[model samples]
Target: MSGSDVRMSAWGAVGLVAGREVSTRVRSKAFLATTGVTLLVLVAFTLVMKFLGGTGGADATVGFAGQTSVLEASLKATATSVGQEVETRAVADEARGREQVSDGDLDALLVGDGTSIQVVVKEELDAELRTALTVLAGNIELNQQIVDLGGDPGQVNQRVSQAAIDVRPIEAPRDFNGEQMVLGMVAGILIYMSLLINGQSVAQGVVEEKSSRVVELLLATIRPWQLMAGKVLGIGAVGLLQMGVIGGVGMGLAMAVGALTIEVSAAVGTVVWLVVWFLLGFVAYSLVFAALAALVSRQEDVGGVIMPPLLLVILGYVLGISILPGDPGNRLVEVLSMVPLFAPMLMPMRLAMGGVPAWQAGLAVVLVAALIPALVWLSGRVYRNAVMRSGAKVKLTDALRSA
Candidate 1:
């Protein structure tokens, strides 16, 4: 009986192929090792950020000698106001404080007659530390001047501290912060790795089947597009599982350890958007990968055949990684992010950073969504025409022109 006249339905054939791919891939040692290493790194990072010493420690340590210890609170407040964390320690005397500074135990030593701020450093103070000390020194002079002029130092200092510059922005962002920016970069990394790994997996799988003459036998029972679709969907399903596990576990662990100060909902939202973009990007890119891969029978030829589409993936990732972390709202990046080719990698990063308009996000999704059907038709044609023609690289023109 002919393969088409067999008992199985078309969907059944696709499912069988997909199931085989999923079973084969998940059993591989490389997948298990990579996933395990990723989890361990995520967990280790969370631990270090929360419990172990990370950036949470003070930036500089200042030693106070004698009566200068009275200025501890004020000096610390000044440093904190400028986003510098200063740890204050009491010293027995100027001699000991200088010793500590020289030994690098203290960043600077504060020693004076309690009348003004004085600093002794091993060499020069850090620029940020210098800024903090300068502000504190100026405040001391201003306070003493106020006292001599018969004005209340406390009241004057309070007013000066309360004063702040007011700025009015033309357009306010919907939601954006340092935390969100970090999440955006993480999202970009996850999507980029996912696309690169899984897309290449599809290509290699295609070339492997073709090079081994396995495609001939598979085509005897299943249609070319079904086999291609099944492989893509199957590998994508496994990759999606990996992405969810890694993202969900990492973010969940970060939240659980209190390492992440952002709202829980924000973290969850980032994970959801990450998964969405991965799915969109994988399906979109893998189609082209499979098609291009079919043009090459040998595994060695796969890279060259797939380089053009691979460049698109790399370009989107590079642009998003390079630009979004610094300028989330670059006009060029924002515009390119809307294009279907770039949307899969760039849009997710933008979404994590927030301030992406609802309409714009929706439109990017729609654009990529619209591109898939065209890819399916075009890619299916190339794969069908080229998959059975082994031993030499198939030209695109010939693939397209074949009946």
Candidate 2:
């Protein structure tokens, strides 16, 4: 066979092995069950957040005294504007309102004494209700001042209208603060969790193959690089499929429940970037994990092999959290976000929060992409050297020297 034919056959063999591994994993019941559970939890949490955001309406009882029916109507209108459903009760006197407030019969009592207003809440009143009462009182006072200055109530109402703010996200297209934070946290968690889960799987698979003396038999049929590449790709494919299913279900549920108000186009773009970043991050980490796995001949040595990668993931997560609330343009943050190991966590967050410039984000992506080939080359050398060595755990320095 020609050299070209040999290369093609080798690649074909690698693809077949990868396909077999992916098929085996996908057929496992654990995979299906875990994906379903993840989808359900994501949907349920999103719905709960929507429910808690006053989408279902409030059930607070408010008492009013020393104000006419017109004033009560105005108060109700003001409360409704702030997403509160005020069940207004006209008290016979301020004393009666105070008594109701104290007796737990009312959430709050509003006493308007001409120019001054007092809001009385029970010690057990809901914190949200108390805050809303304060806000409503301020609105009332502002309206009174407008009227005192001969300003029309209609004009004041127009001036004080609270409309929904439409968010046009530049990089990551989350519609609200909840969605932005949720997506960022979820992305970071998935990166960390996937690395741990799949990395362990790779290590355990290697140990099992080694302990069972299957590696010697397999080595006769395929090259070591092909074996390693096939395993990594297959497991990476499984991870991607699981992530895609969960993400699609989540997006649909979010839209259905009105938890997400962003445009579908924008959401799709964000998911595309997520998948792109996941692939890059997984490839980089999984190769290192597989190389680490090959360094140990026994299952007992797996922890020592995997600890460094796990620690790196944890450090990235901590750094991502700390930088999330600050300006992403800070010198340290920019440097960390560009580092390939930390980029998966920090870059996604910075993108979501509109923290990173487009050029910087592109540059970070390019840097990560450039680093992958070097990592792959290094990991391939480590795996070839250590996979055949049968003994105590191999040191990282020895693996590098072997390269």
Candidate 3:
């Protein structure tokens, strides 16, 4: 056969092997059942969160005494603005209001003495209530100061209005407060688990094939690189499919519970980045795993061989969590997020949190994409050199020499 014909034949064999692996995994009952169970669990968790938040809002009851019509009106408006239906009760006296609060009949008591305002609660007030009251009190105090200083109320109001500047976001703005945290956490967990599960499958498959001598028969028809590529592609396909199902279920639950809100568009963009990065990360890790698997004839040595990549994955996750609450634009965070190994976890998080510049995100993705080919080439060389050897355990030096 001519060189081109030989290359075409090899590519065809690789496609066939990959196709078989994909088909086998897709058709497995285990995959279907796991997907179904996971979807149900996610839906249940979303429902629980929604119910808890709803209940928390419903449980607050505030009493007001000695408050003027203006103060009451302002409090009501503020509560309405934040989507809270405050249970506002008019109390005849401060003593009664404080008594009700102490007895738990009222969550909090708002007392206005004309010159000063006080909030009396059983203990800690609801966070939402506290925030609303604080803003309202600040406005009231400012207006009083303007009147006391002989300034026109209209002019004071205009100054206050002008002081309220629109908060322009430096990065792409997200509509939801905590959506980035949820998205980053979910994506990181999924990627970490998928890598560990799928990489182990690749290692086990290699060990099993070798132990059963099936690899010898397969090698006659396919090159080591083709076998490795097929396994990686097949498993990668399965991982993507699983992630798609999870994403669909999560989106559905979010929408059902109003968690999606205006942030759905942002979340969709994050997921797109997640899938792209996941593919690159999987290839980098899986190739290394496949190569390591080839170093041992027995399945037992697979764990030890896979340790370095696993440790890297763990470290990435730990660092991602550590830096999440801090400035994502910090030099250390930026450096970590751009590195190929940690980019899979950190870049997605930084993107979701509105921390990364567009150019930096683009550059990080490109850098990771560029690393995959080098990793594949190195791993293929390692596999070809070590797969045929029978040994207790192959040292890295020996493997490199053989390669």
The TM-score, computed over Cα atoms with residue i paired to residue i, of candidate 3 is 0.81
lDDT of 3 by residue, 100-159 (tens): 998999988888664455788887989898877877777778778889898887686677
At residue 278, give the lDDT of candidate 1: 86
Error of 1 at 161 (Å): 3.5
Poorest stretch of ten by lDDT in candidate 3: 172-181
Off by over 4 Å in 1: 1-6, 48-55, 90-105, 122-124, 174-178
* Tens digit of per-residue lDDT, candidate 2, span 1-403: 7766534467776787789879998999978888888888888887887787646555688787875444577667766766777788888998988898888888877766634556678776666666666675676678788899999867867765754579887767323354666666666666666666776777777776766778788777888788888888888899889888887788778777888776787667667767877788788888888889888888888888788887887788788776665444456766888888788767766665444567878988998899989988999888877787777878877987884
lDDT of all predictions, in order shown? 0.89, 0.75, 0.79
TM-score of each: 0.89, 0.77, 0.81
- lDDT score for residue 400 of model 3: 74
Error of 3 at 50 (Å): 2.0
| Predicted candidate 2, C-alpha RMSD | 5.7
TM-score of 1: 0.89
Q: How many residue pairs of model 2 clash at the backbone? A: 0
lDDT at 53 for candidate 1?
36
The alpha-carbon deviation from the true structure for residue 308 of candidate 1, after best TM-score superposition, in angstroms, is: 0.6
lDDT of 1 at 392: 77
